[model samples]
Target: MSVEIKISLNKGLYLKEPQDSKLGRKMIKHSIMLIEKFGFEAFTFKKLAKEINSTEASIYRYFENKHLLLLFLVNWYWEWVSYLITMNTMNVIDPKLKLKIIIHSFVAAHKENPNVEYVNESKLHNIVISEGMKAYHTKDVDSENSKGFFKSYKNLTTSVSKVISEVNPDFKYPYALATNLFEMSNNSIYFAQHLPKLTDISLKENKVVEVEDMLLYFTNKLLKK
Candidate 1:
């Protein structure tokens, strides 16, 4: 039996929840595919509508605009990652082992989940690495931030930061280190694939062990007392 996981997101992100109906679910399924294939700059409601065999107006009924749709997808990824970390670390008594598990979860999040039929997590992960920053790197970020648009990402950071504090209560920058590790996991893979000179790991096939090794190496050295 495949258990469906429901991730509740901010209500303000969409005029209508995409998971509530067949059409809405189709919209999300095709949007992630289209965005991952063409990049966000070229993705629009018309393209999504055509890909899903729906009308542009129908997509607008669900999302206010493309940017909001992107935010919704990006936020969903953050919450998914947070869930992975929790599930992977559950009942693990050792803080060091838990942290290692957390790092592995971050790298392994790109793998497809059979439970989430609508969202192709591997493609969604590619979208996140390539386009996630645009969700918040905007002039209206302050306004959106005030509306709790970034709560998912912040909560994920806070949870990992707690684990870091457990590992070393005296560590001065637990939150910073937590966020850095998360960002580094994504950034390193992005660099390895596109800008090879910028990263030490080489992108060959779909394997990510080298990336995981590099992250663990950094984590061990930085947290060493």
Candidate 2:
């Protein structure tokens, strides 16, 4: 059975929360689908408004600009990932296994959640892989950081860092490893798909398992004291 999940993102990522109204929700739903369909660079409020039969000003009321909307979607993706890690690890006793599960969750092909039809998680995962970094790689990043724009990502790294510490209390670079694991999880697949020479893996059948195994191996070796 597929479980339904509600994702709440950091407030600073949006001018007004989209979940508060029907049109607001529709905006998010269509935005996710459109962003996945068209790359983020080509996505715009005018296009979104036309798709939803609403005015661009209506979207502006919820978001200051397209950047904020993209940030909100990416932030929501990270929070959803964190939620999955927490839910999957609950009641597990082994730290190593818990970390393994976390690594696997990061690279695994996303499945659509039937209950949450508005957000196609599978497409969202692909969007994150392709355009997630654009949300933070800008001149305004410093100002955004000061406003807690990257809290979900930070929390995600911290969550895995804790697991690393659990396995080895003396491990000195938990945060670094945690962040690296997160980056590499998406990066390996990105490289494999777009720049095959950069990665040994491929998008061939069971390649996800290979990537997962590579991550687990790296993580286990690093966490092993």
Which candidate achieves the best lDDT against the true structure? Answer: 1
Instruction: Rate residue 215 of model 2 by lDDT.
Output: 87
lDDT tens digits, residue span 36-68, model 2:
899998999999999999999999999999999
Q: Which stretches of candidate 1 lie over 4 Å from their true place?
A: 112-114
Model 1 C-alpha lDDT versus the unseen true structure: 0.91
By summed lDDT, the worst window of 10 consecutive residues in model 1 runs over 110-119
lDDT of 1 by residue, 7-126 (tens): 899999999999899999899889999999999999999999898888999999999999999999999999999998888788899999999999998888978483878899999999
For model 2, what is the alpha-carbon lDDT of residue 201? 76
**How far does residue 127 in candidate 1 sit from its true spot (Å)?**
0.5
- Model 2 sits at a Cα RMSD from the real structure of 1.8
Error of 2 at 84 (Å): 0.5
lDDT, residue 120, model 1: 92
